[model samples]
Target: MNNLTNVIKERLTKIGKDFNEKEYGFLNTDERLRTPVLITLGGSHAYGTNIETSDMDIRGISMNSADNILLGKDFEQVANEPTDTTIYSFDKMTSLLTNCNPNTIEILGVKPEHILYKSDIGEELIKNKDMFLSLRAVKSFGGYANAQLYRLQQKSLVALTPEQLNAHIVKTLNGMRDMLEMKHDMKGIQVHLKDGEIVVDINVNDYPAESIAGVLNVFNKTLNDYHKNSVRNEKAMNHGKISKHAMHLLRLYMMCEDILLKGEINTYREKEHDLLMDIRNGKYLGEDGRPNKEFFDIVKEYEVKVEYAKKHTYLPMEPDIEKINNFRKRMNLRMVEQITKRR
Candidate 1:
């Protein structure tokens, strides 16, 4: 273990009870506070872009007791403030894994030194990490990127009119639809961008009508909201928020592109360190405190790269569902056995 990991472990063990009381206002029993199967640094630290002011965010997973699962106890996750530590129950983690959640998946890919703690179960989970990756990454990563882009655009500008917000909504929705069709082999559905409006056509027989309708509903609701409220605050741009979102926007693209092209996630971000740090440090912003033209150009470049990676990617159109189901079953059985032994 490295010095950081050692320090984390020492703090958790030495002052765990007091810390929990002060931060969460609840005391964990010894059984509930024992060794976690995995613990790793999260956020910018895991991505290797931490500045001196970055807070240490820790995430972990621990096995749920037999009673907690079978008996339907209320255990799902634990949190302690100040230290910013959070640990999810194994059951909840598995559910998130099935969805290919970007945050949870990164925990399985942190660099060795970033791993503050681990046990045999955690080692096994890391060894079998590939089983959790799937085509779902396209949607998850793209959705996250779109969210960051939305935030960046929203906060970087001094004022945003309803018309502009409507345009952004349409663009985001169409982007989401394109990603879904690219990875899922959907057919007979069309999304069009025209005059700052989104036009979608769906062949009800070829696609789930409800899903298509859901998208339309979201678009309609957003349009209605914009029409209702026409003006927004005209305050100065928030450079810090813009910088943070800008960095994450590129990071999400890089992660998605890597997963598609290389069939793996590199949480340490060893290759994109300098560029990511520059973005975090406001190198991409202009004197007006807004992202410059060069920033948009970089965004366009990554978008094209992600598209290319998607087409040439060796990954299948869908994950090996059978393989993943078998793996999950085995892990569940192991959890059952462990819980039984404790009983």
Candidate 2:
């Protein structure tokens, strides 16, 4: 345990609370439920963007217990909600890391002092973190940034102009087939936009029932999301939300650009603290409580750079799934070994 972690534990313990308090006995103190392998600093502290009043966030990964594995029950995560602490099961963590998830990917690259605890398994996980980096970072990080921007824009991702809406429909229609059949059958479905109307031509045959069901499911979900995103948030116009979310919007873009351009992860924005803090502190917000022109102009510049990096980056289209699966199997076997030893 590090001094910072000890300080936190001591502080909490003194106040009639502990990290493994009654309700959270499953934390480090329990063997039947979960056991954390790595716990690191998260949120503003990890990003070097914290103020004096910033909340503490502790994030970690836990190995699946014997009961979880053998009982075939799902054990995804345990959280200390009040403290913003979360320990994800190893399997869930692997799933997220495999997709180059923006939030979890940063875990492997936090400054050393920020790492509160790490076991041998955690060390190995970190060593192979590079295996998780891929072209997916562009989409994952960019999508997250867009989500933040949506809050600031008071709009949903599905907010589209007349032409954009038609284009979206065309794209969705083009994918309405099974993964294998989509490639060969996409040519059969031709969609065209004439003046403001959509014209579609379907000349397909022998559509599998399963694929038809899959398309219906996907289309239903997509339509629901579009309906939901069309409504704007009333509170997004507030200054606090605008500025804070704008800061994150730019941060996400920066993080994505870094992964694409540098091929390394550095979560702490030490050099950009001034710029990020200024944005968060409302320096870039206008008198009307909206993000100012300067803010959007800055964001636009980053957007262009991110797009360029996305196109030119050397990263592969996907992570090495086979290698990642092998590593996960080894970890699971080790966990079972430890459990057997206790037995």
Candidate 3:
């Protein structure tokens, strides 16, 4: 572990009044902090993709006081800045877990070294992590991936300034290349690249001449836009955004694919370090701040894998709801017993 992460671990354990004063006014006293059910590192660190500049993110679950729950006092979660830590109440955590929330489910799969604290209740929760896995992961992971794709598209469109406009054009052309290769039969088409200029030629023998003309017209317009704006601004390139979104887009697909194929949640990306690190470092991104052809090919390959996994997965059409409910009842009963013992 690095020095900064070590320091973060120390500070997270010493939950002070400043951290709780605004978020948890009900916890005027230090009762809640005295015994948290679980605490673990999250985000890039937990996923094993941390760089020197990565922020420390911590997540945990704490039991609510009987009075707080019984009286219907609000204590759903607590978020503290500087460390970017958030601890959800046990009740809220369980509810989210049942829905197959990506954030909450990830807590169950954190590496042992990343676990700062874990009580018996927390241990039990981790042991029964499989209870939370189901077909629901498909929707959750897919939704997140779609959101990332939307953000990338939105970012590509809003180009007011000249620099931003040029960047947008570059990104659009890169996407066009990927779309053409993936969606269309490339046998009749040939792409030529020279001095940053791209030309496409279509064989009339393989494809209808009119159809080829329509495709070429669209490509020509895009090329025209790029030449008209012809100025490049080094600062306009959003390498960080490209790299971050690219990494996450691939990661989400990988996670969902694993869930469908093996019925397991693997949060750590140790096996994909080389590819992930390259993406994170912008190695796969073009000068336009968009992922290159190779990246799109990988995405296409994973899409096929996930489709196959969905059809062949051993998981049921839905989660075993009765088994999950039974587990929840037992955990709640244990919580009640603990409260009674305290009283």
Residue 321 miss distance in model 1 (angstroms)? 2.5
Runs of candidate 3 with Cα error greater than 4 angstroms are 1-35, 70-74, 158-239
Q: How much is the lDDT of residue 98 in candidate 2?
A: 83
Local distance difference test, per candidate?
0.72, 0.72, 0.67
Span of ten consecutive residues with least summed lDDT in model 1: 17-26
TM-score between model 3 and native: 0.68
**For candidate 3, lDDT tens digit of each residue in 21-122?**
244333233465434677787898788777888877779887776666567553778776665878888878876776577778888887777776777888
For model 1, how does the per-residue alpha-carbon lDDT over 307-342 read when each residue is reduced to its tens digit?
898888887765666876676557656867776787
Q: Clashing residue pairs in candidate 2, if any?
A: none
The true-versus-predicted C-alpha distance at residue 67 of model 2, in Å, is 3.8
When sorted by lDDT, best at the front, the candidate numbers are: 2, 1, 3
Per-prediction TM-score: 0.77, 0.74, 0.68
The parts of candidate 1 lying over 4 Å away from their true place are: 1-7, 11-35, 71-76, 79-83, 157-165, 175-236
Better of 2 and 3 by TM-score: 2
Candidate 2 TM-score over all chains jointly: 0.74
